[model samples]
Target: MRIYELGDGTPEVSVVGAIHGDEPCGERAIERFVDEEPTVERPVKLIVANEEALDAGRRFIDEDLNRAFPGDPDADTHEGRLAHALSREIRGTTVLSLHSTQSYAEPFALVDEVDAVTRSICPHLPIEYLVETGRFSEGRLIEHAHTVEVECGLQGSEEAAANAYWILRAFLSATGVLPAPVAGDTEPPLSLRRRDADEVVVFRLLDQIPKGPAEEYRVFVDNFQRVAPGDRVAAADGEAFSADTEFYPVLLSANGYDDVFGYAADRVGTLA
Candidate 1:
């Protein structure tokens, strides 16, 4: 991991990037932040994780790092060891873990639960949605107290990099690492100025649409849109698959993952 420290006290905030090697947007954002060299009000740590995998240009060296949280230092897999180290790196800090998704082109926040930290900072993010991963939080970094994970945008896209950079800036300001933008400050990309800092559309993950053993598959629903019973969601080979119940698709994609189509979620009302 590459660590960048700004300011002189004990760091209370941390932003982690490149948990998955294929998602380089976050790392780019971190580099951009380093270039700007903003003088922070409080100490902050910016980390670029999974360097080996990143060098290899693959998702992981042995396993998905995001799913190996609180990992074992003596474990066999590279990700397992890395996870343990990362967990230690951000412990007790308000962490913002950056990620880029293949499913959606829009940014969104993800949390293990909605708590005081989430309620305060999530609203400041450049996003319109927040997803709570209950049962799915098992080994995720967000399961740790005060950690927020963001899906910046479509993986490897220029827009994703821009979103990640601005989102991290907003997070720093919200957590007091950097002074909040004042009235005379120049407008940033995707300005949060016009947004209600108290509002966010929330969703709770219900289940994932597994790819099963299909050789060829295609998703037909727009992400964040509702799908009801009998609604065709995908096609595998020559057979069409329809939903059995009503739910909204969060990360809906045709070939986003090797084992899943994306997530099915339920709207849980807005946070204001």
Candidate 2:
């Protein structure tokens, strides 16, 4: 992990990037922002995690770092040891961990569940959706207190990098590390386009959309769109499966994961 800090005193605000080496958007955003040398109202720690994997140009050297949180210092895997150190770096801080996804080309936020910190920060983000990982939060960084994770956009895309930078700026502004955004602010017009009525639709992950072994796979529905009962969800080797009940697809993508296409989520409510 590589860490950089702006301002003085121990930082209570932190930003982490590049946990998955395959996702360069986060790292790109951090470097771009740091290049500006913007003045900050409070200290903020910015980190580039999984540097080894990044250097290797692989998703991980041993295992997924996001799934190895609060890891053991004595653990065997490279990620396990790195997780332990990374966890310590952001502990007790209001954190934004950046990421990009293949499932969606739009930014969205995720947390273990809605809480005071979430309610306070998420609404200010340039996103239309907020996901509650709930029971699926096992070993994820968001399980740590005061952490918000964002899926910036399609992995490896320049748009994702651009989105990540603005999202970081918005998050820092919301947390008071930077001046609040205002009319005629330096931020581009896209950053000001908050969701409908300034509300973020909330979704709770219910179950994984299982995928069986097949030569090829395909997904039919769009992420965040509701799937009606009996709607065709996906196909494996031309074998199709239909939904038994209504659900909103979250992170649904063909070939995104080996064992699953994505996740089935329910629209719980909206956070204003």
Candidate 3:
């Protein structure tokens, strides 16, 4: 983990990046923002996690760091040890952890569950959707209180990097680490802007859309779109599976995960 601190005193606001080495957008955004030497209203810690995996240019050296949170210091895996250390650094802080995804090209936010912090911070973010991970939170960093995880865009894309930077600025602004962004002051890329009279749609993870072993896999539905009962959702080796009930595809994509295509989510409500 590499940490950069701005202003004075122990930071209660933090921005984390590069938790998964395969997603470089977060690291790029953090580095670019630090290069500007922007002044902050309060102390903040910016961290680039999983340096060893990042250096190796792989998803992880031993295991996925995001799934290894509150890790054991004496754990055997590299991610396990790193997770323990990273957890300590961000403990008691309101955090923004950056990430990119293969399932969606648009940015979205995720939290362990919607709360006062979610209501307060998510609206200021440049996103149209907020996900409640619920039981799926497991060992993820968002399982920690007051932490928000963002899927900036398609993994490793330049657009994702740009989105990550702006998202970081928005998070800091919402947390009072930086001043609020003004309209016509600076243009945001990819049509990203703060919520203006728009309510963010909230989705709760209901279950994982499991995938079976197949030589070829294909998805027939667009993510975030509602799937009706008996609609063909995906195919594996020429065999198609249809949904038995209604659902909104969250992170649905072909070849995104080994054991699952993505998640099945329900549109819970809107966060204004």
Instruction: Give the whole-model CA lDDT for all candidates, comma-separated.
Output: 0.89, 0.93, 0.93
Candidate 3 weakest ten by summed lDDT: 189-198
- The sequence of per-residue lDDT tens digits that candidate 2 reaches over residues 1-272 is 99999999999999999999999988999999999999999999999999998888889999999899989999999999999999999988999999999999889999998999999999999899999999999988898899999999999998899999999999999999999988977764464356484799999999999999999999999999999999999999999999999999999998889999999999999888
> Cα RMSD to native, each candidate?
1.7, 1.2, 1.2
lDDT of 2: 0.93
Shift in Å, residue 167, candidate 1: 0.4
Candidate 3 residue-wise lDDT, 168-208, digit = tens:
99899999999887877685774676445378999999999
Clashing pairs in 3: none
Higher-scoring candidate on TM-score, 1 or 2:
2
lDDT of 1 by residue, 29-58 (tens): 999999997888999999999999888989
Per-residue lDDT of 155 in model 3: 93
Q: Ten-residue segment with the worst summed lDDT in candidate 1?
A: 188-197
Q: Each model's TM-score, in the order given? A: 0.95, 0.98, 0.98
Best first by lDDT, ranked? 3, 2, 1
Model 3 TM-score? 0.98
